[model samples]
Target: MTDYGHDLAFGSFLTPSAGTPEQTVSLAMLCEQVGLDLVTFQDHPYQPGFLDTWTLLSVVAARTERVAVSANVLNLPLRPPAVLARSAASLDLLSGGRVELGLGAGAFWDAIEAMGGQRLTPADAVQALAEAIEIIRRIWDTDTRGGVRVDGDFHRVHGAKRGPAPAHDIGIWLGAYKPRMLQLTGRVADGWLPSLGYLADGDLAAGNLRIDEAAAAAGRSPSAVRRLLNVSGSFTGSGTGPLQGPAARWVDDLTRWALEDGISTFILGTDDPDDLRRFAAEVAPAVRELVAAERTAPVPAAPVPPAPVPAAGPAPLVQSRHAGTGFAVVPTPDDGVRRSSRRVWDEAARPTGPAPDPARRYTRQELVGGQHLIDIHDHLRAELAQVQDLVEQVAAGSLGVGAARSHLNTMTMRQNNWTLGTYCESYCRVVTTHHTIEDQSMLPHLERADPRLAPVVDRLQQEHLVIHEVLEGVDRALVALVSTPTGMDELRAAMDLLTDTLLSHLSYEERELVEPLARLGMH
Candidate 1:
C-alpha cells in the first residue's frame, strides 16, 4: 500500500435545503458535536429551493465551535474571483481558520444565463476557473509588495490592492473529475474534492495517477495535493448495497479507499442526524484505528548498534531505557474531578496498570493497540455529551419531543416518540461493541501474557457488565419519559447515572490498560 502519510480527516456534506434551513444548521452542529472535522453545504444559487450557500456556511460556522465550514463547491460563474476571495477570506478570518474553499467550474449554462451570469463553453469554463484561482490566490497574498494584477482571457484584475489576509492558509479545493481539471488541480490547487456520484467505479485510481503525473511535471510533490471526497451511502442492519450492510463493511470499504485511493478526507452527504452520528461515532473511529494499525506496523530492518554514551561527567537523572527509540508518552486525566452530580459505581474498586519496569520498553504493535482504545473512548465521551445536551433541550422544551424523535429514526426519518430511545439504543450498541471486543479479545490476551493482570482484567470485565446495566437503565428511563407528562426528572436522572458510570469506567480502564497495552501488547 502507498502511504501518502497525510493525516486522514472526515467531514460532512450537508444539503442547503431552504425549507429546512434550521435543520441543516442543526445537522452541522451535530457534526461538531460528534467530532467531525469539517462541514460543507452545496452551492447552487440558481436553485429557488436552496438557501444561499455562503450565508448558510456563515451561520453554520458561527454556530459550531470546532468543525470547519465550506461550500461543497461554490459556483465560480456566479461569484467573481475578487469578491469570492474577499468573502472566503472574511469567513476564514471570522471563523478563526475553520473555513475551506471548494470551487467548481460553471455548470448548467441555461440556468447560469438566467441568473445574470455569463455562460461559458465547457473548455472555457475550465480555463476561467484556472484564471479565477490565480486571481483569488493573488488577492489573498497580503505580504506581496506590489498591487495584485492578473491579465486573463476570462477574468482580469489590474493593480488591485491585496486582501485583508485570512486567519490561516485557506485550501483551494477543486471539484474535479475530468483530466483537464484534475491536471489543473495538481498544478495549483491544494486539494482535489470530488463527489462519488460523479465518478465511475474505477475513476478514483486513474484520477490519482493523472494528478500525480501533473504534480510531478509541475515540480510539486504528489502528496501536496490532498484528496478529499464527498461520499453518500445508506446504513442498513441487513442486506448488502454499497454502504447498506453492517458497520464492518463500512470500515472495510473506507479503509481501502484511504489505503489505495489516497483519499484522506471523506465528507458524508446526508441530512439525517442518526446517519451523521453513526458515521462520526462508529465508522470514522474504526476506519482510523484500522488504518493506524497498518500504517504503524513494523517494517523489517537491519539492526544497528547504539552509539556509546561518552564516559561523561554526571549520570542522567531520568534516563529513558527507550532513549534511542521513539515512544510517545501517554496522557491521562487529573485525579477525582467530577463534572457531573450523580454516581453510578464506586471508584475505589477500580484497578491500576502494572508499575513500570524502567528497563522494559514497548513495541510499536502494542502501542497502536493501546492508542486505539483511547481513540474509541474519546468518541464515546463526545457522544455522551451530545446525549446530555439533547436531554437538556428536551427538558427545557427547546427541542420538542416529537422533533427529537424524528431525528432519532434512521429507518423512517419521521417524527415519533422513540427519538430518545432510538438514539440511546444506537449509542448503547456502540458501547457494547467496544466492551465485547475488550472482553473477548483484549482482556484475554493481556491475562495470558501476565497472570498478575488477571485481577485488573476481571474488574474491567465486571465494570463492562455494570455499564451495560447503566445503558439499560437509560433505555428504561427513555420509555418512561415518553409515556409520562412530567418525566423530565426521569430523563435527567438516567443521563446522570450514565455519565457517572461511563466516565469513571473509561478513566479506570485507560489508567489500568495504557501501560499494560503498551508493554504486554494487544490483539
Candidate 2:
C-alpha cells in the first residue's frame, strides 16, 4: 500500500480582466476561508494588462493571512541573479518560508525585443540559467562566509551574504519540458511543472520518459523529483460524478493522469473567484478525506509515502514589520569572493584601441552586483601607478617625448578602462540595483568618518569625467594604431598626455587625504 495524502495547491493569475486590489484581497480572504493548501500569484514583469506581481504580492502579504503566497513563476533571467535571490530570501523570511521560486530559461521574446536586451539563443539562456541558479543558492547557504564566491563562464559574484533562510526552505520549481532541462531538474530542481496539452495534439508521455531517463542519470529515483502541471481549460466535469462534476471531473482527470505519471501537484488556473471557490468547497475536501482514509488504511510492509502536497497556507508577507531588508547584497566579484572570469587572464584580447567595445569590454556579470564599480576602482589604482611613474621620470629629465608617448598608451588603457567600464558597470549597473547604497553604505560613511577628506572624493569623481573625455578623444585618433605592435610615436603622444593630466589629479587627491592617510599608513 502506498502512503497517500491528498494535497492541493491553488493558483491566482491576474489578467487584464482581473479585479482591482481590493477585490483581489477579497478573493484571497475567501481562499483562506476555504482552506487552500497554497496560493501562488502569477508575475509578469512586462505584463501590460496586469499589476507588477511582486509589488502586488508585497501588499498582499501584508493584508492576507493563513495562505502562502508566491509568483506562479518568476522570470528570473529578467533580473540580476543577486537582486532576485535577495528578494526571494526576503519574501521567504517574511513569509516564514512559504515562498516558492518558479523559474524558467526565459522565452519572452517580445519583452526582450522591446527592451533592446541581449536576445539569447536557447543554449545561452540555459547556460545563464545554470549560473543564475547557483548564484541564488550560494547566497542562501548558511555556511557562506565573507563575500559571495562564484566563478564561471557566465557570472562572478564577489560580494554576497543574506539572512533568515526562509522558515520553509524556498522551493525551486522549473517550468520547462526539454530533455536536457529535465536532467537539470533531476540533478538540481526541487520540482517540475509541465504544462498540460489537449488530447492527441500534444505528447506528454515522451517528455515524461525523458525526465525519467534524466533522473536516472542524476542518481535519483524517477519519482523523487516532484511533478506538477497546469490543467487545460477544456477539462470539463464531463466524465465523473458530483466529485466529477464540471470542476471535480476536470480535477479528477488531471489527478488520475498526474498520479500515474508520479506528478502530485496540480495548479488549476482560473481568474473566476467563484470557479476556484467551487473547487475548494466542493472538490478539494472530498479529495482530502479520501486521501486521508487511504493513508490510514495502508497495509504494505514497505509503503512509499505520498509526496507531501505544497500547502497553500498563510500569506508569507502579511503583518510583518520588516521595514528594512534583512537580505544582504549577494556577494559579487567586487567583494573579492570569486576569481575573476577566465577572460580576465586573456590579456591578448584586452582592448588597447582608441575606443573600447562596450559589449565586449564588460560582461553582464559585472554590472549585476557592483563588481564593475569595484573593477573600475581596481583599474584606477593600476592606471594611477603607471601614470605616476611616467610623470616622476619626465619631471626628473630621465624621460623625453618618446618615453612620454610609450607610457601614454598604458595611460590610455587605464583611462579608457575606467571610462567605459565604470559607466557600463557602476553608475549604470550598481546604482540601478540599489541607489541608496551609494549614499547609505558608501558616501555617508566616507563623510561621517572623515569630513576633512571631502574635497578629495570630489576630485576623484571629477577625474572620472576628465578620464572619459580624454579617452574618447584618444580613441578617435589612435584606436587603430594601438592595436598593432609598432607606432611608438602614437604611444608616445598618448602616454605624454595621460601622464601629465592624470598624475596631476593623483597629486591633488593625495594632498587632500595626506593628513588622514599618514595617520594610519598601513592600516
Per-model lDDT: 0.79, 0.51
What does candidate 2 score on TM? 0.51
Best by lDDT: 1
Candidate 1 deviation (Cα RMSD) = 11.0
lDDT of 1 by residue, 167-270 (tens): 99999999999989999999999999998888888899999999999999999999989999888888776546556666655665787799889888999998
Listed in order, each prediction's TM-score against the native is 0.63, 0.51
Best candidate according to TM-score = 1
> How would you encode candidate 2's per-residue C-alpha lDDT over 25-61 as one tens digit per residue?
6666666666665566665676666767776666666
